[model samples]
Structures are given as structure tokens and as C-alpha cells.
Target chain A: MPRSAHRRPAAGRLRGARGLAGWLFVLPALAFYAVFVLRPIALTLQYSLYDWDGIGPSTWVGAANYGKVFTDPDLFDSLVNAFKLIVFFSAIPVVLGLAIAATIRRIAASRLALVARTVLFLPQVIPLVAAGIAWSWLLASTGVINQLLSLVGLGGVTRAWLGDFATALPAVGMIGAWVLLGLCTLLLLAGMSKIDPALYEAARLDGAGPWREFVSITVPSLRQEIAVCVTVTVIAALASFDIIYIATQGGPGNTTMVPGLQIFYLAFSEREVGTASALAVVLMVLVIACALPIQWFAKDGNK
Target chain B: MARRVRPGRSGAALVIAMGTLAAACAAPGSNSPQPQATGTSAVSKAPACGSAPITMNGYFETGFPLPKALTTEFTKQHPNVTWNVREDQFAVITQNAPRVLADNPPDLMRLPQVSELVKDNLLKNLDGYATAFGWDKWPASQLEQLRLGPGGRPRGEGSLYALGLNMSMTGVFYNKKLAAQIGMTTPPATLAELDEVLAKAKNAGITPIVQFNGGATGGLAFPLQSLMAAYGPTGPINDWIFQKPGATIDTPSNQQAVQHLEKWIKAGYFQKDVNAVDYATMMSRFIDGQGLIMFNGDWESGNLDKQMPGNVGFTLMPPAQQGGKRAAMSAPLAFGIAANAKNADCAAFFLNWVATDKRAREIGVEIGGSRPMGPADAYMPEVAADKVTASTLEAGADIAKDNGAMDFIANATGAIYAKSWTPNLQKLVAGKQTAQGLLTAVQADYARQLEGN
Candidate 1:
């Protein structure tokens, strides 16, 4: 009995040493996360509670900055603009990605399919700032787009895409779509490739059309990828800055103002660091609120 | 697939962390203000720079190229001094000010946010240097623009924190060929005459005014300020800019000025899609003779002289009525010494030399692409080649003599242009709002900004 008890302690010690080794493996990353991520977020949270001009002494205003975030119409408008961007950044990309992925999947082993995928994915590799500048030039009133429209005798329908009050937000959102479509398509294609070909083959043998095969087999397999695409694109859309900054700078009467740009302007330009921090915290909460559900839905797809 | 998802998860985690760090680090209060070490360099003494191996780190705005000759001459005089200069777009300078000034500050930096920098105590007070260097002899109007009150509040009569490298004025630039086509022989002498000229230009199928309202380049704001200067009291306008406790931009004359711009918009005097054009586009359009006139600053004078020499004419925005005092918006390409500068003496020497040195003034006019700080008579030889640049210099000189100059309205606050003026002017041009509505919105924003103080 004494021997068994002593053996139990020895086994426990071995397990404990193994556990310590496991913890040591994770220590570096955890330290990095604590220092870089957690500390900054905590500092941001603390700053949001004050009225800081980014210089001099800061006054602790205590929740007033949060109140400002909730009550300010401009802040709410920025939030609404972000949500509106999701329609372009997430919805349109996923829908178009599915179509592209399905079409390309049929000829996946062909050279033309490879070329098309490469061409479509070109935008993802380009820097967002360069892409923004190119699009701004293309969409300028006297730019090539209008020149083409005039060639087609449709110049009257064209306006400054990024500089008109009514079209600026949608125009910026469309840029987001253009950037995300390729990435989404590639991801969905990866997911579609992993799906058992027998499922589509069976659907086809049962007299299902191509559309039906896509809707049932292709889409069902791509749920996780769609979730991934939605999560990433939604995050990009909400936190968009460089593209919009280079494009319109939220101009034409602040039509394209998003939370990211507003937070930057408030903090850097206006010196209202406190209000900016509050907006930033609110944005993080929003990103979390948005990303968690998509992740959960993505995890559910595995079942 | 797990590999791909793992990278993404880690990427997002880093982004979340980085986003917060970016904000936290940019906050100026993240670090306590370092104790200021004042330099004991007195300009009263003759050139005393020895073989001290003085190193200077300077940051200049992209558009304003630091005069190579100025640095070369300084180096030639002080053979041991070495300069490490960096140039960036003004936006980058403004965005990184907090970080740059908080850590190792450059010896000299272009003051984009003067008020904020002063408030943070990131700038050195130049009173001693100014006194010793005879910078006090410069025009009071010019010197007053650099003066700051306690905590670096702007437009106050206190210790000067910066000095202008050269004068920059915003006025009307007309295409000579287009002006002749419209039967306008000379630049408009009055606001009414300007309107008539615009009408003639429009009838002749030329775009009248090439103004960029898409971004904050003071496209429409300059002309509006000029009109307001014509009718409004200079005291009140200066007070408003100086941020006197009771100052307001909602004066009757100011309202009339904005209303006048609205009328021009209604009359189609500005280019089609005025709000759509940016600064570069408008400048290109005007230079290409697509428009009869451009409302812009003297920064483009060098380019104008280069691109279409003898084709462009320059003049101040004419008075609201005939025989009114000539006025325009004029400030300087201002630079300030950093409080934490290791070589404050070298920085102050540069500022003083730019303002007073003969070769420096010549380079300031010709190579530096800026009007000299001294009167036009000081460097007439340098601008003798470019008529448009000469005309801009003359306009600035006249405005200084008449004491009719005022700072840009956007200068009232760092955020005024981006948050209020540009957007409101765009709204007005789009016909979505009236002049009074614009004033109300701007005043409300201004008050809110002040309340934050």
C-alpha cells in the first residue's frame, strides 16, 4: 500500500514536469500578447475615461467620453457607414466569390482556370494605398471611366464617383468589394476543393442542375470559408483607413466617414485623444461583437 | 487548412494588439514632458560656430524643399557642421508629430500643428534668439503670426516659438491667354469686376474658377477670406483668429462673404465638379489653360513659372467693392526649433540666417520656391526671371504694407479645415445647404472645439 502511494506521487511529478514543459512552450507568445496587446488595450480603456488633448495634463472626465460617443450624431453616422460597408465588403464579396469559385472549380485543373484565378487575385497582392490611388484616378470626373462612358454615349449618367455626396460612401464601399472579391473567391475555392467530389457527382447523377449542385454541395462545404471571408472582410471594412484616406478623406460632406478614419482624425488631427480612444474602444467591441458570431457559425460548419 | 487558419488567427490577434498600441503610442500624454534645456547661443555675438562637429536633423514638408544652398552656405561657413535632413509630405509630419516629438525630436521641424506643439512644450521659445538675431526688426504683422501665448495657444502676444522661412500668400492666378480671350485685360480690381470677368469667361465657354473643394487646400476659403477682409473689420477677424475669448466667425460681414461664394456657385462661376477636383488637378487644369482663373497659394508660383512662363498672371483677391483696401491671406512656411534638440544653436542659426543672410534670401526666392521674408527690395534679383512669382511677391509686399493681411481661417484650429471648412464648403457648393447654415455649423463646431479646452 505504501509502495502504491509513493508510485502515485512519482507519476504525478512526471505529469507535473510535462505540464511545465507545455507551459514553457507557450510562455513566449503569452508574454508577447500580454505586453503588446493586453497592455495597449488596457491603456486605451483607461484613456477613454479622460478628456485628453493628446498634450499637457489630461482631465479624468469619467464616462463623459463614452456618453459623447453614444450621443454624437457623427459618431453614430460613422457606425452606420461601417455597417453599410458590410453589405459591400462582406455580402457582395461572398456572393460573387461563390459564383466565381464554382465556375472556376469546374475547370480547376485547366490552364485557363489557373490564369483566371491568378488574374482575379491580383488586387489582393497590391497595396491598399496604391489600389486606392488607382481607383481614385479611374473614378475621377475627368478620368478614364468617364471617358469610356462618354465613348459609349452614357456620359450623362456618370458623376464623380468618389467626390459626390450621394455616391461617395457606396463608391468607397465598392472599392472594398473590388479588393475583397478575389480573396473571398480564393478562400471559397480552397474550401470547395476539399469537398468530396462524390457529393457533387451524386447530385449531378440525381438529375440536379449545375445551379442546384452549387447551392447544395458547393455552398454547404464553403460555410466555413464564407464565415472566414465575412469575418475578415467585415473587420477590414470597419477598420478601413488607408484606402478611404487616400481616396476621398471622408469628404464631399463627410459622406464616406467611417469609424477608423474618424478615430484617427479625432486623435491625431483634432487632438481629442480621449474621445478618439472611446471611439476606438467602441470599435473594438463592435469588431468583437461581429467576429464572434461568424467564428461560431464557422465552427458549426465542421459538424 | 489548419495552417492557413492558424496564421489568420494569429494575424488578427496581432492586429487587435497593434491597433491599440498604435493609438496608445500616438497619444502625446503617453510620455511625460521632458525638462526643457535652453541653449545659450546669443546671436548678438559674431559668427562663433567653430569646429564643433555640430549635427543637425531637420524635417521639411515635401512641397517646401529646404534650400540646399542655405544648408550648403551654413556648412561652408561652419565647415565642421553636418546636416541630416529628411523630407516628408505634410500629412506624415502631422500624423507622426506626437511620436517624433515625444521621443528623439529633430533639431528643426516644419511646424504643422503649431498650437498643439506649443501646448505640448515640444517647441523652444525663440524670444532670446529673435532678440539677439534682430528678428524683432521684421514686420510686426509677420512676427505677430509666430507669437504664441502661454501653453502655446495661438495668435497671442508672447514669446515667439517659430520664424518664417519665407512669406506664402493665397491670391488669384489668371491665365493670360484665357484672360485675353474673355476681354479682361488686367486682373479684376474689385469683387464686382471679378464677377463680370467670370461671366465673360463663362460666355466665352471657359471655366471661370478652377477651385478644389474636395480636399483642404484653401481653394474657396482664400477668396472668401479676402472678401471678408474687404468688408469686415480687421480687428474682429484678427481677434477671431487669435482666439480671443469672445471672438466669433458669425459676424454679418463674414456671413455676407460666405453668401457671396454661394452666389458664385449658383451662377456656375466655378468649374463643373468643383468639389470633385483636388489640388493637383486644379493646378494642372489652370496651368493647362482649361480655366480662366485659379484660387491658390504662392507655393505653386514656382511650378507655374516653370510650366507656363509668361502665360499666368497673379493678383490678390480684389476688394468686395472698388477702392477698398487690398487684403489677402498670407502666412509663412514656418519652422520651429524642437525643445529637446541637441543642437538648438545650430537650429536657431539656420532660422536667423534664412531670414537675414543675403545669399540665403536669394536662395529663398529662386531655388527655395518661396517669397523672401524681407521686403521685395531685398531680393529683387532672384525673382527677376519669373513675372508670376514677382507679382505674387509684390502682392505680399503690398498686403504687408497695408496691414490688410490675415491668417487662413483654417488656421483657427488644426481640425477646422478637415472637420468643418472643407466639408461645409463642399456642402454649400453641392447646393445642399446655404451660407447661413454653413456659418451655423462652423460656429457650432468652433464652439465645441473651444469647449474642449
Candidate 2:
């Protein structure tokens, strides 16, 4: 018994010694997260409650700020914009990604599939703001896009695409879609690669056709990945700001005034710290509102 | 082998961590944009002509090609001067004033007004330089404006920090050809005259004014300031914005200004979505010649000249209640030295040349692009001709004999105009509320800035 008791400490030490290197390996990452991510999040939550300009002392304001957000028109307009983005990024692109992945996977050369995936994903590599700016010039009032339309004699259709209230929302949302397609295509392609060749062979042996096999085998296998992609894409769509802020600046009236730009206008232009914070909190709440259900599905898919 | 990337229940946790880290690191303002450090070879603080070619640094929004073209002309006259012109957003130069002064400051900046630049004491006193250089060539009105405070500060008594080289008038720019097409003999000379023109234009199916209620650029502030000036004198708006001289909100001019806009709105004097437009889009509409009037600065003349192909015209916007000294916002955009300039004297010499001599006229004609303050018929023949177009250049009288022509930046300059003014007007035009609500919000914003500052 004494020997066994003595062995306990030694055994524990040996086990700990084995894991010690692993713990050390992770410490840098954890420290990085604690410093940048976790700390900033905590600070954001703290600051979101206070009325402070970037300079000078902060004043404490309670839920009164968030309470006011429920009534802000700009907040609601931005939410609608966020919702409008889902059609382009989360719904349509993911389905298209799935199809492209399936088609590319059937190709004999693995390298070609990889190349195709990389090429398809090139848009994601382009800086989104730069892409948005390029698009802005093309879509300007007297730009090439309008010129081309004039060429086709559809001059009436070629209004200032970014400036018009009618088209600004969709035009901005399309940029969000453009940003995500590359990652989606790559991820969906990766998932297709992971589908065991044996399962596909079994489906073929069972006399299943291509569509049947894809639906029965590939679809079930990718459910988890699909869930993940949806969650991520939805989060991304909700968080879209760079494109709108850079291109239109929430113009043609408040038509382009998405929630993100509203936050900026509030903080900078309106200089209402309380209102801006409230709007930010509302944005956070919205992100969570959109994300939580998908998060549940992701968790369930994990199980 | 590197394990495939996964999340949460990840075997390759480091990969996931790195991915997150990369994304987080790549996010907004990750490195936090720092000002580009302009290089400097230190020169004497005291004003003396340098053996090294004086590097005169100036910042303007556009017409960069003009300045580049004038380099040869300037070098011919003063072989020892070279313009190291750094072009960026004017706002960037303003925002970085403290840092620019502390570190390597630009030698000269094309400032909008002396007030904002002078208050911080960033200007070099130009009194001695002007006196020595015999800058008697400047107009009497502009000469009065050149007198700086004790130390070339922007204050009336401040030193002459810089000369007023080029001036852009802010009044009504109307299409005379379009008005003639619509059977109107002349552009509006008064608010009532404007009303009649607006109605006739509306009947003719042209939007009266291209209003960008969304931003502070001449869209909303021009009209709002005009209304305020028209209502009473320009003194109240001045008292509130610059002097803090106890101007009450509830004045007849204030009400009159609000009523004037309301009348215009009821009569459909503006575009359908005036709140929705920006300055660029407004220009597009005006260039298309759909609108009868555009209330912008003198700079728009060059723009209209470039953008509008044929039969375009210009006119100064009439005063709100034009009877007294025809008050318009007479803002003469000027230049100043950085607080900690590496070569203060070189900068001043450059300043003196641009502000005092034939170079002043030449650079004004070339660089300012809108209106040249130097003797007429120099280089920019475009700006020198046409009295209607020239009205904006003429608006910068040293004194406000009446309230109608109060200088927007100096006398009645309101901080709210930069931030709240356009947005408030937009909101009002969007049918959010009355101008009263907008004005109240502006007053509230002023109070906040005052208290917070």
C-alpha cells in the first residue's frame, strides 16, 4: 500500500511530464487569445455600456442606451440589409458551392480539382474593400457600366447603381456574396474529398445513379460541414460593413444606412455615444439572434 | 504529417487557433493606420532664403496636375524653390495637426479658414514678412483679411500667417441657358425671386435645387446658413458658432429661414430624395441640367465646366431676405505653416511668394482652379471672366456690413454645420420633422461639443 501510494506521485508526475510539453505548446496561443480576443471582447462589453468618446473620460450609462435602440429607424434598416444578404451568401452560394464541389470531385485528376478550387476561391483572396472600390468605379454614375448600358440602348436601366435607394441594398449584399464564394467552394470541395471512396463504390454497386448516390451518400456526409458553412456564412453576412461603408457610405438617403454605418454615423456624426453604444449592442444582439439557432444545429451536428 | 484543419473537437488545434488568430489580426484597424512620416532636412526657424531650394509643401483636394504644371513657372522665377506638394484628403491634414506640428510638419497647407488653423496657434506670423515684402498688390478687402494677430495667428489681430491667393465664392450657380429655355429672364436675385424661379422650373418639370441633405458639403449648410442670415443678420449664427456671443435660437430670422425652406418643400423646390443625394450625385444631376439651381462653392464652376458639355451657366445664390448688405458666406480659403516645420523660413518664403507676387496670381489661377485672387487676366482665363461666376470670388469682403453675406467659416462658422447641419436638413427634408427640430438638435449638439470640449 505504501509502495502504491508512492507510485501515485511518480505516476502522476510522469503523466504530467508527458503532457507538460503539450501544455507549453498551447500557452502561446492561449496567451494571444487572452490578450487580443478575450480581453477586447470584455472591454467591448464594458465600453458598450459607457458613453465615451475615443478621447477623455467615459460616463456610465445603463440599459437606457440599448432601450433606445429598439426605436431607431436606422437600426431596423440595417437589420433588413443584413437579412437581405442571406439570399446571396448563405442560401444561394452554398448550394452552388455544393454543386461545383460535386462536379469537380468526379473529375479524375485530383490536382485539377485542387486547381479549380483555388481558382474559384480567388475572389476571396482579393481585398474586399479594394474589390468594392473597383466595383464602385464600374458602377459610378457616368462609369463604364452605364456606358455599356448606353451602348445596348438600355440607358434607363443604368442609373447610379450604388447611389440609388432602389438598387443600393442588393448591390452591397452581392459584394458580401462575392467575398464568401471562394471559401465556400474550397470548404465544400474539401468535404467532397473526405467522402470515403468506398461508400461511393457501394452506392454504385447497389445500382444507384449519380444523383441518387450524391443525395444518399454525399449529402448525408456533408450535413455537418453544411451546417458549419451556413453558420459561418450567416455570421459573415450579418457582420458585413466594409463594402457598404466604403462604396455608398449609406447614401441615396438612409436607404443604404445599414446598422454598421448607422453605428459610425451615430458615434462620429451624431456624436451620441449612448445611442451608438445602444446601436452596437443591438447589432450584437442581432448577430446572436441569427447565429444561435445555427449554432444549435452545428452543436447537434457535432453530436 | 499536418493534420487536416478542424474546429472545436480538433486534433489540429494549433491550425484552428492560427486561423482564428489570422482572421482576428486581419480585422478592422488591425495595425491601426499611422500617419505617413514626411521626410525633412532641417532648416533655419528664422525666415531667410535658403541655399537649398525651398521645398514648399502644399495640400489641396484636386487640380494636382495644375500645380505640377506650374513647377516650371515657379522655378523660373525663384530658382531656389521647389514645391514638394503632398496631396491627401484635406481632413487628414487637419486631423493630424497636433502630430504634424510635433514631428515633421508640412511647410504650407491650403487651409479653408484662418479660424480653425489659428485657434491652435499652428500659423506662423506673416505680419513682418508681408510688411517687408510690400504686399500692397492685394485687394483692400483681402489686405484687411491678411492682418494676423500678434503671432501670425488667425485671429483678426493675429499675424498674417498666409496670404489669400485663390478664393471660391459660395453662392447660387444656376444654368442661365436652362433658365432662358424656360422663359425666365434672369436667375433669382432674392428669396422671393428664387421662389418664382423655383415654381416656373417645377412647372417646366425640372427639379429646382440639387440638395445633398446627407452631408455638410454645400448641400444643406449653404441653404441653412443663407436662411439664418436672411432671417435676421448673420450675427446670431456667428455668435453661436464662432464667437459664442449669446445668440438666441428663437429669432425672427431663424423662424423665417425655417419657413422659407418649408415653403420651398411644400412647393417641391427640391429633388424627390434630396436627403438621399451626395455632392457627386448632385453634380451629376446638375450637369445633366435637370436642376435649375445648385448651391455649391465656386469650385463647382471648374467642375461644371469639365462635366457639363454645353450651354452651362453660373449665378450666385441670392440672400434669404436680401435688403441689407447682401450677406453671403464669403469664405476665402487660405494657407498656413505647420507648428513645428523643419524649415519655417523656407515655408514662409514659399508662402510669401505665393501670397504676395505674380506667383500668387499664377498659382491661384493654376492651383486654386475655382477663382484666382491675384490680378485678373493672368493664367486662368476661365475664372477671370463672367461676373455671375465671379460673384463667389467677390463675396469675401473683409467686413460684414450686413448679415446676409456673413463669412460661413470665420464669422458664423458653426461646428454643427460640419456634422449635424447637412444630416439635420436631410432628416427634415426626409419628412422626419420640422426644421425647428433639426435646429434644436443642432443647438443641442453645439451645447454638447462646448461642454464636452
Candidate 3:
């Protein structure tokens, strides 16, 4: 007991030194967070309670801006539009990713396989703005897509896909799908590579077909990767700006107006900074609300 | 290089293009003037930038050419003074204005739009400088257009907040070869005649209009405003645009103008999938000789002169009735001194020189592709070097002489174009809505904005 008591001070000093070093290491990141992240968020929160025209001195409007976010039909419509994108950005990509990953797992490791894998992952490396521009050109009325269609004797179906009210939102969503599909497939394929080859062999001995093995082994093993893809794609769907801004700009009669674009227009063009900030806050809350359940499913689905 | 479909605006290349685009939403004035409110006059010489190690900060868009010339002259006059200029996208400047004005601001700012800046008191009132420089000698109509009431409310009768280096005019730009093919030997004398020309061009299997509505709606609004000015009573149109008391945009004449646009769209005069085509594509295709006519402002005159010199001709949209007033849309590329400008005097000095100096006026016309607002005799002969410039100047002179100039309707509110007009116009063109429906929607937005003010 006497020896332990004597050793306690020395141990306490060592522990204190380690604690100080840990804080020292984290101080730079903490400072950055306070200034760049927390500070801006704090300022935005304050601005959300006002009726400022961005340039003019702000008038205190309390919770009026927040109230508007809830009551304005356009804001609600914008939120709904953002959610609709998740079908294209998250659900379809993850499903198609699984299928592609399963199919690629069976292919021999030849040069053709390498080339296919590289092509599948290519979209992830390109800048999103460039991708959007490419897509816009492809989808334009007289663009290459229509030229191809006309060549195949399907010219009657050709239309301005991005500019038509009926197709604009879906057209834009499909661009998101095309961009995200590559990422999802690559991630799932990486996960599939990590699965034990012995498991598939054992399943085959149990009279399991390829589909059964895939459903039982591949799907269950990729639970975490699927979650990650879903979370990332969902956030992207909600917070998308560059692609939409460059491609459609929430136009063709506001059929594609998402919260992110709406916030940009309100803050910059309309000078309604207060409302823009309010919408931003609402969007943040929505992303969290939408993401939490998907994360939960990813974490618990295998069990 | 052809224009690009820039996310916000085409920026520097479209500086003059956007200049006219916002003129509608940025009505210089709407309210009745306060009786006997006139700036006092005092003739003054060029401001001296005293020899000191001074750095004047400035912000401008790409196409504005005055900064280099002004800086060079200023530095030459005062060797110790230097200009530090920052060129940015128009959208960036506009979006960052409030924060920029509140924080560290430049000495000079090419204001995106006036009403909001004036309301926010982000600009230094230029009346004192106007009085000091004997600017009262300038035409009252030109100066009055710069005035705005307190908080930027009721434009046109308060204090001057900005100064324009030069003005721009909106009109029809025709492909001369296409026009000849369509039997339009001369410019149409009236809107009805122009309609006939469009039909003839369509019958000839040539696209009559080359328009781009994907990125911005200003392309659509140009012809719409011209049509309104041609058929509608000038007073109500101007008053509605300026946001005058009891003004309303849902007038019968405005409805008729919308219907005419609808008719044009229905007659297949415009390109198929115009809403999908971007500004750059439209200009490139037009340069490629794909269209007979395009409604645009003179800001593109320089580009037209450079790209397809002899192939294009310019003319203002004619009035609906023969011998009726031939009104056109015209406005200036305006700049204002920041309220917190460190070198307010230096900025004011530049504005003074740009407005009153003959050398500056010559530069404004000959090189800048700008239309002159002063006397006809004041125009530079050097402008004749560019055919587009010569024709635009001629049209400007006619409009100025007859007082047939009007501001853009969108200038009534900053949100009018993006929030209201753009979507409605797209819907109208798509055949999903009526002309009256479009006007009603736009009027509601305008009223809602006014209520907020």
C-alpha cells in the first residue's frame, strides 16, 4: 500500500503531461473549427433571426424567417425536390452497384477486367462541373444524344430533355445517378474483393446457386459499405449545387428548384439573406433527419 | 471566343449584355420629384490626386475597359498613386456586396444594381460631387435617372448614388444575308412589318429568331419589352417599370405584348428547344449563320463586329402603329463609390473625368462599344470604324432625339427576373400557361416585393 501511494504522484504527473500533449495536438484543428466552421454557423444562426437585405442594416424579425421557411410553399417544394433526388442519387445507385459488383467478382482477372474496372471508376475522378457540362451537351435538343437517336430511326422521341418541364427534374436526377453509380460500384466491388473465397466455395457445396450465394454472402458482407454509400449519396442529393447550377439552374419553370439552389438565389440575387440562412438551417436539419435512419439500418441490418 | 454559359452571368463579355438585362428591374425612378429639388452647379477642373503613396482599390467585371485607362491617366497625373483593381464575376460581386460594403470595401465598385445599394446606404451619395463639378449642366433626364429616394425607395428623385461611364441600347440584330433571303431588303418600319418579316423568314425554312433562355431570361425579355414599348402607352409602361405610385404591370398593353411573344413561339419563329440552348451556343450558331433575327442589346456589337462584321445589321424594334413613337430600352453601365471608400475623392474624380472629359467620351465610344448620352455632336467619328458601333450609335441618336427611351421593367425589383418573370416566361413559351396568367403571376411577385419594402 505504501509503495503504491508513493507511485501515484509520479503516475499522475505522467498522465497530466500526456493530456496536455493531446490538447496541444488538437489545438490547431479546434481553432480552425471555431473560426471556419462554428463561427460561420453561429453568424448564420444570428442572421436567420433578422430581415436583412444583405447590404442594409438588418431589422430584427425574431423568428419570422424561420416561420417563412415552414409556411412558404416554394421552400417546401424545394425540399421535396431534394428528397426526390435521393431515389436517383442513393437508392438506384446502391442497387445497381451491388449488381455490378457481383457480376465483376465472377470475371477472370484479365486485361479486359482491368479496363472495365478503370472505366467504371472514371467518373469519380472527373470534376463534377465538367461532368455536368458534358451531360448538358449530351442532353441538349440538338446534341449528340439526339443525333444518335435520329440515326437509329427514333427521332420522333427526341426532345429537349433538360428544358422540358415534364423531364427536367428526372433528367437532372439521372445525371446525378450516372455520376454516383461509378462511386457506389467501385466501393461495393472493393468490399466484395475482401469477402473470403472459401465462403463462396462452401456455399456452392451446400447446393447454393450464384444468386443464392450473392444474396446470402455478398449482400450481408457489404452492409457497412452500403451504409456508407447511402449516407454519402443522400447528403450529396440534398446539398447539390454545382451540377444543378451549371446544368439547369433550377429552371424550366422552377420544376427543378431544390433547397440549395433556392438558398443561393435568395441570398445573392434576391438579397434576402435572412430567408436564405433560414432555409440553410432547415436543410441541415433535414439532411441529419434523413441520414440517421439509413445509418442505423447500415449498422444493424446485418444483425 | 464565343460566350460561355457561365453559372450566374456570362460576366465580363456580357457586361453590356447584363447592363441592359438589369435595367428593367433597376428603374432609375418611379415617384414624383420633390418640388424645386435640383443640384446646385459649380464649374470645376479635374481633381488633382496629390502626390502621395496612395493605393486606390477597385472592383469591376471583365468587359469594362475603363479601369486600365483611368488608372493609367490617374497614375500619370499623380505618379505616387497606384490602382489595385480586382476583376470578379458579376454574380460574385453582387452576392458579396453586403458583406463587402460592411467590411473592407474597395474605393470604387461597379454597382450590380442601384436600388438595393442605395437602400442599404452602401454607396456614397454623389450629389455633393455633382454640385461641385457643375454636373447640373448635363441633361436633366440623364442625371435624374441616377437619383433615388432614401433607403433606395421610389427611385429617380432623391440623391445620386452612382455614375455611368456609358449607356447601352437594346434592339433587333439581323443577319443581313438571311434578311435578303427572306425579302427583308430594308429594316421593318413597324412591329406589324417585323411580324411579316418573321413569318416570311419562317416560310423560307430559316429560323427567324436565335434565342437562348437556359441560363438567363434577359434574352426573352428584350423582345418582350420592345414589343410593349411599341404597342403600349409609354407612360404606364415606364411608371410600372419605375415602381411609381399606383403602378401595375398587368395592363392590357402588357398582356398584348405577352400574347405577341406567345404568337412568336407558336409560329415556330424561335429555335426548337430554345430553353435548352445556352447563351454561348446561341451566339456561336448565329455566327454560324443559323438565324435571321435576334433580339439583343448593343453590348454584343463589338463581338458581332469582330466575329461576323459585314453579315449582321442593327435596328431598333419599330412601333406598332406607323409614325407612332419608336421607343427602345437603354441604360448605362453604372459605378458608385462605396460608402466606406478610403479614396472617395479619387473615385469621384474618376467619375467626373469620365462624364465631362472629351478624351474620356471618345474612349467611351471608340473602344468601349458604348452609346453616347450627350449631344449628337459630342459623338466620336472613330466609332465609324466598326459598322455595328456606327449603327448602334445612329439608333441611340434617334431614340435620344425623340425621347423614345424607356427603362427595363425588371428593374422594379431585383427578384423580378429570376423569381417571377423567368419561370413564367418559360411556362408561357411551353404552352402551359396563358399570357394573362404570366402577367398576373409577375404582378403578384412585384406586389409581394413592394409589400416587403
Evaluate every candidate with DockQ and list the scores: 0.33, 0.11, 0.36
Judged by whole-model lDDT over C-alpha atoms, candidate 2 comes out at 0.61
Mind giving the per-residue lDDT tens digits that candidate 2 earns over A1-303? Answer: 123333555765544454444555676887688668765554555556666543224567767567666664546767787778788768867888888888988883878877887788888888878988887777766779889999999987876676555676777777777677778877877887788899989989999999998899987888878877888898777777788777766654456666777776666544455567667767778789878887787678667
Model 3 stretches astray by more than 4 angstroms: A1-9, B1-46, B51-53, B66-81, B216-218, B373-379
For A210-288, candidate 1 gives per-residue lDDT tens digits of 8888878888777888888999999998888888988888888888889999999998888888899999999999999
> What docking tier does model 2 reach?
incorrect
Model 2, span B228-280: residue lDDT tens: 66556665554454434355554666867876787787787877556546677
List lDDT for all candidates, in order: 0.80, 0.61, 0.79
lDDT of 1 by residue, B1-453 (tens): 111224544565567566656655444364667545444353345333456788789877776555456778888877888888888888788877766776868888887858778777888888878777767777777778788887666475787888888878888889999888778897788888998999898888888988888844436776678778876767788777777788889999999999988888998988767777888888788878899888888888877888998999898888877777887777877888777777777788777777777878877777655567753445454466457888887787788777887778888887888888888888888889799998889888888887786
Q: What is the lDDT of residue B298 in candidate 1?
A: 83
What's each prediction's clash count?
0, 23, 11
Off by over 4 Å in 1: A1-21, B1-31, B34-48, B216-218, B374-382
Candidate 1 global TM-score: 0.91
TM-score of candidate 3 to 2 decimals: 0.90
True contacts kept of each: 0.45, 0.05, 0.40
Please give the lDDT score at residue B86 for candidate 1: 83
Top candidate on TM-score is: 1
